[model samples]
Target: MFKIRNIGAILLVFFSISLVNAQIKIGDVLPNITLQDTKNNAVKLNSFKGKTVLVDFWASWCGPCRLANRKLVKMHDKYKAKNFEIVGISIDTDKSKWIKAIEKDKIQYVQLIDPKGFDAKSAVTFGVEALPATFLFDATGKLIAINPTESQIITQINKK
Candidate 1:
């Protein structure tokens, strides 16, 4: 019985550590992940340093993600010239479907393919558990918000 209890305690501690490590909190530097764009060009998350960026994690099959993309499109247009950028990371394993959704949504921002669905490396690193998850980073690549609303994103972009 003592051995079983010890094993249970160890398992609990291991899971606790994992959960803590998975979280990417505000003020944490964005993870350095290299993913491919729609055109198959390698893009690194760190490359966006020196620019305010919104990293959006989404899937083509998610209806809420589609709606969020529409709002993001408008935000992109309004803020692109202001040095704000949006990086859409699709968690869709189907490349064609992901590209189709981008084209249909008229998304002009940088689009990346995760191809791992919810278990994508970036998603796991950032602890993204839901569709339409967004992380806002400052010009220095430090995270500012997580799952922020469209208005909250715009407000952050508009800040000096």
Candidate 2:
């Protein structure tokens, strides 16, 4: 029994290490992954370089995500001309659900799905493990903040 418990502990440690290693961090260059937009047009991250970027990781099923969309839409309208852009990375597994939510919520920002689901390359690159995670970047494309709230977006914009 003791030997079995020790083996289990070893396995747990290895699993934790792998998860940690997979998480992305500050200073990591955003990977250039392209996905179809709500309009079914291909959009790439590289196209938004030299602009302030707000990346929101969400899913169709998440209530907070839906709520956040309303504020995001307003922010998009407010700062878009200032070269600020918001992008939604949907971690939802169902394509229909993602598309429906985008329409239902009237989300005006650019939206994309992790066709690979939650463990998608972009999610890993952003070290995202939770829904409604947000990352803000400067015009130079470096990460400035992570997981900021709705009001914080306003403050950040005003600062810029």
Candidate 3:
């Protein structure tokens, strides 16, 4: 009985470690997810496949996410015409709060709500563990960078 218990504990630890390590990385194709926008519109990631996309995982309650939203708005305004888009995927528990933040931030880019916290299908596919996480993809729909700052986004767009 003791040997069985010890084996079970080891299995549990290994399973947890694997779960935490399950993550999307650079060069991985972005998974197509159909999440809802504030308007209840179905916004599919694959819909904007041709353009270089910046996928930002954030939540209204997150202070850093709020700051990142401000920067993302600026970045969107600057490079939108250059075939770049910033897609804000909110991990907010409340849809109303997510919409309010979008209005308050004047975020012009695409926004989606993930009310299931980080366990939402989109976040799971992207393996997002924290707020304000970002993934940048190129025009060909290939991920180029992960967790890039606003300045890094600007530089990447300019390089294209």
Candidate 2 residue 160 Cα shift, in angstroms, is: 6.2
| Model 2 spans > 4 angstroms off | 1-22, 150-152, 155-160
Name the top TM-score candidate.
1
For model 3, give the 10-residue run with minimal summed lDDT. Answer: 19-28
TM-scores of all predicted structures: 0.93, 0.80, 0.87
Which candidate has the top score in lDDT? 1
Angstrom error at residue 112, model 1: 0.6
Clash totals for all candidate models: 0, 0, 0
Residues 1-160 of candidate 3: C-alpha lDDT, one tens digit per residue: 9999999999999988887666677888767789899899998887877888999999999999999888788778888998899888988999988988999999999998878997888888788888878999877888889997667777777765
Rank by TM-score (best first): 1, 3, 2
lDDT of 3 at 45: 86
Expressed as tens digits, the lDDT of each residue in 22-56 for candidate 2 is: 66556655557787787788889767778878988
Residue pairs in collision within model 2: none
The TM-score of predicted model 1 comes to 0.93
Give RMSD (Å) of candidate 2 vs. truth: 3.0
Model 1: residue 126 alpha-carbon error in angstroms: 1.0
Global lDDT of each model?
A: 0.90, 0.81, 0.86
